[model samples]
Target: MAEKSGKAFDFRLFKRLISYTQPYRFTFYFVAFAAIMLSIFGVLRPYLLQQVIDKTIIPKDGGLLVYFISLMVGVLFLEVISQFLFIYFANWLGQQVILDLRIKLFRHMLGFKKQYYDKSAVGRLVTRAVSDIETIASIFSQGLFMIISDLLKMLVILGYMFYQSWQLTLLVLVILPLIVYATRVFQKKMKAAFEEVRTQVSNLNSFVQERITGMKIVQLFTREETEYTNFKEINEKHKKGWIKTVWYNSIFFPIAEMSSSVTIGLIVWFGGLKAAQGDVITLGVVVAFIELSQMLFRPLRQIADKFNTLQMGMVAANRVFAVLDTEAIIENKGAINLEKVRGDIDFDDVRFSYLEGEEVLKGISLSVKAGETVAIVGATGAGKSTIINLLSRFYEIDSGTISIDKTDIKTVSLPSLRSHIAVVLQDVFLFADTILNNITLNNPEITEEQVQAAAKEIGIHDFIMSLPEGYHYNVKERGVMLSSGQRQLISFLRAYVTNPGILVLDEATSSIDSHSEQLIQDATDKITKGRTSIVIAHRLATIKNADKIIVMDQGTIVEQGNHNELLKISDGYYRNLYEVQFAEV
Candidate 1:
């Protein structure tokens, strides 16, 4: 149910939230001072009005009336100034804190291992970084200081009211307990409603993000009506969650308003009776008490609302902190810093699993000497690409070791290690940027001339220049402006410009047409010269000339040798695989 109970206040969460404001302590202190000043000014005007009624207007002392009126206006002016400072600085402090927090969250996410992201939704993380942090900012701007100021003002008003007429003040206290009970109930209900609202918001964001990213598939499969129905269901849930909050507000505010109205009536009745009965209560006392009652009740009413804001902000903080608290970051405990690598690779009895008890790569061992071109081929689910994944340390092996140049990769700093390796995947990803930026990825060290030279060598320079803007052409998101082959060609240029020691092509030629396959094949042959390369290809013919071929089945190596030697094994795994392709062609 959307009405599930939750804590209206969490002390530890609040303390952690306050720590983010440590850098802006001066602004924090200034805001505190402004709150105090606003509270003092709030009560002073009502008290001054009492004086104006009693000492000047009542006795018709015109000279004294002018003086009191001037005093009241001056107090009002200071009150406005103090109110401005409090509001301005509080919001300023909130924005600054959220800015720092958003940056910190994003930086932490960048360090997380791929495993962390495997089961996480990009949209939920986006909500945590963007909207959730924005809610947290309200804690400073409208929740804490505003609540404090209201409380202080109410206390001062109560003190002054008791001093003037203990009898009338005692009568006003009669309505207090009922209002307090109502406020407590309202606050609890609202907290739960707000929590439900936040949850639905995250779900809505996730659904929209996933749908948009997969819009191509949705259109291709003609699932528009089905997906639209799904979106409406989600949107309806979000609307219902928000309506729960509205329902609670509708019930609570009117109750608060009625209590305030009833209290004012009580004061008027009791104070008027006392004055008529020859008591100390006078007209000025009655009038001032009326104003004081409002000062007292309005804030009490607002306190409930502001407390809800505080609770909602705290809920958001808890969500944001949950992501910040994730310990899924890759362990980079290596002390060795390899500036350059020899590209000699070894995997000794390496074992791994994405899920427990479901091993994907089992007791696999392989070696590639420096400057050697090795190809791995297998049917789907045969752990072909898993080898490249493990080699790149994108996923840690459950057992055994992976080494590069005779040094354990675990003993090398991640940046220093990855710098010497380049990977080109079957599905190439290009940012929404110009071709030059996509190729160089904005690396200042690689010049335009260098990219042009590498493209010419790979035989894609003319193709790139034939585009509308040539190298400066925008590829749009995910390279939608280019064909599958063109994006792959750009990926090759991207990898080659790095001057990497090792190259990994994971089915890079799988989906392209024959023409593009030829171009990529030629590019691959050229770049593989004098460099250690690992090629995983669906087309056995493409890797026929590779120095060595490792054929895998069910996560284990079934056959491995040079292409000619593998062909000689009748009915062998590689032989059958090669024969099927040859017959298909």
Candidate 2:
């Protein structure tokens, strides 16, 4: 029942799906056998009725009648047992396959670089992981085995009917072509509708996710009505997609029913005429053919319904498999290891751009000695933040060598390289969990007491203690409950507790309260005293105590020195920056 061409099934997709069933091969094969048995049993009920009416009931054979009824009851029990086996194992297989597929998909996504995420929607990926895979489960539970079983049942029923009486079989068969034609058209049309429905659902999910995350901005700008209108458009498209499927169903199913009703009437009329004329057709045969015709036609309709489920499942498989097929991740080709870093860093002729030929970091070279504090001061888009991104290997550089100690960063494992460095950014993201878990991030080596000690050392212990639940406080989604200043303190504490060899503070105090700024400055002084620290700052006052100050302009380093040394030059970029900021005072 997997999606097919206009003429035949898509065996390639069928093979691919079957390949996944290899792990549970024994169970899959057993379920398939049970489905065959179920099909065989499906035709038995009509066959037994035909034999009973002809051989036992009409002949008045009481002994044979009791034996046949007992046998019929036994067949019913066998059919029931086969159905249970088919349903239970098929569903079990689907659930197991989805569990494995979801885990693989989530793990594959974790390895993808920042560029992949920049161009993709979170909700789209989530749909593939959750909803799309659920659709695939229908392949087993509704589509694959059930379609085969129904087809087999129809074949057996037709064989019995033709053997009993060909004239009546031919009468029923005349309307079969119409049902088949309608079904083919219905399958194709519904597939297109299902595709549109999936696309609209993904769009709706992505739209709602972004809007909910940024609801504060929408409310601040009084744009609720504008967003609502946009949401209505997306929702309407989704509704129209489903309506098209319903429209197709309304047209196709009634035609099928009419064809079935016509087939039954033809059998009754033709068999009646033939019986009156000669002994060619009997009452038992006429009666059995009627029941058999329902068996044949009802399955055709049921199969069309199941084919819709199969089509949707194939669409979902294509979407999920598309994500798995993407090769957009950084490969680990390096074996360099680091137990403890010496913190010597270098960027030699580093050139990088998020997009090709749109250079954000232009041939910039700089170095930080062991235990040195280098503060970078620049305007927005001056590549100050880009430097941090490259150092962390969040994005691959266009052309450059970023080295730590004597080893190039590209020659070292990502975990080893990043484990030694800690970064605190302006925008802090906190999980909707306890404060202690946020700080530790579930790192086993960093104990609760160690985090508490680090907080106290930075003079934030008293502030954290003032919270309603202290270290156990739940920060809510994205730390919405805490002020920006409080979140910044938590970030600082998180970085400090890591005891990293190198520390980075990027615009860390740019958007915080005065009290928080003072506390952060005091904390920054204590943390950067002996570590290799790189600070990207907008405020020139923050870098005055830095051992080295690198001034950037338009992706290039224009000046480099201590605060006093750079200020001595009258027209230097750092001096000019200092003048503009302090000129207000």
Candidate 3:
């Protein structure tokens, strides 16, 4: 699912992620300064400890001991303060970076053409916009900032160790190569493991999201046992991926700890022998070296773990940048900004295909004059919906042009073009919000009074008032609390409130009961009056009074006439289709 990229660390991605901190550069610099202060204060503690042991305890000088102890305590207090500032500011900086990143990524996704979403999983995108971004924050909080602090602390400890006695420092270096090699190997393996873990997490999220959304289908088919088994398989894979990283940590940490112990043992053995020989090495010096050795090895060990953190953040960054790098966005290059549209539409030799070499809309042509209602009747897969999609520029046409009021729609700004159109589909979606908010979509320009007026004009004001809270009623997620027909009515109100120049009803009455259909039909009549309307007719009876009924076969129009004229052709496709529907009724 997730592929490992070049190197355990990606400098390009790291640099790009760092650029987000430009807005908070002062905080970033402050954290770096804190890291330096922490290192300097850390070195001061052991030196003070050596002074207390040699200059006070050895000579029984209590006053000198008090002075050194106070200094040591002071350094410890400052070190704590530095540590606090480093943690608080680093986390603050990280939260700010991911906040901007998530917003930019979401805005980018919003501009992507429908074609891009046609092949994308909602769950995978959710992971990118939410959880994956959370992981990238660790790059600042635990990855880069901590690594720099630990490395600086280690270097400072190393310099002081050499200053005390270069020979012992050389001895400490003996076990270092082994630790470094182990850390290097651990980093490589952990990077791959973390990438796989992220991939599995995305897969698990996608599977769960889809299954939950379609739980009705799973139960309807009595497939709970089968689906549970599938879930278990996916979950088992996720667990195994994480356990592999755990296995690496299990092996690596203990080895580094044992290495640290061995170095400590070597220090005590060498320093003890030198003391017995009356060399410069003394009791205070040996004890201080012991403290310094632990200080050095601890960070070296932690650096390995923090490097994995860095690696994981890099992996997540790569995934997020991949989404940001996509060229699937609909470019708003059109200079035209039409404030109002007369709604005269034309499709001149329009050809389109959802997939290459498999055209869904053949080179077809159609027109609808301003304030006219035209009905397109076709069987499923006959490209009736494709025509609507193209008209709205949901998918680009491969050849030819679609025009609104004789102006090419491609030359009109997207917001200006789409603002003039409203669509009501068979499967209507409503947000988990109050009915008024859902209808108005939280547009401040359209107030509660306007929504009430639109509802009354569409003949659904009484229906809404009959509800427990009227327009204030909350329609839960996707309007599940409401019936299919009720949701469709809400969608109608949503569309009508916008006062669009063009109205589209794409099989809007296909699955509703007779009573709801009557309500929708009444609403439809009111909304479409004097508006250029396109109706994709599922029931042939619904379009009997349509101004123009264009019958489609495959992807091309087979008949174009009013009901009486089409019925006059006894052997025509429309006549036969109408007769079949009449028989079914």
Backbone clash count for every predicted candidate, in the order shown: 0, 0, 0
Candidate 1: worst 10 consecutive residues by lDDT? 1-10
- Tens digits of per-residue lDDT, candidate 2, 83-106, equal 999999999998888888888889
Task: Give per-residue CA lDDT, model 3, range 23-134, as digits (tens).
Answer: 9999999999998988888888889888888799989999988888888888888989999999999999999999999999999999998999999999999999999999
Error of 3 at 333 (Å): 0.8
lDDT for position 19 in model 3: 94
Best by TM-score: 3
Kindly report which residue pairs in candidate 3 clash with one another. none
Best by lDDT: 1
**Model 3: number of backbone collisions:** 0
**Candidate 1, residue 176: how far the Cα is off, in Å:** 1.6
Each candidate structure's TM-score, on Cα atoms with residue i matched to residue i, is: 0.97, 0.96, 0.98
lDDT scores in order: 0.90, 0.90, 0.90
Model 2 worst lDDT run, 10 consecutive residues: 1-10
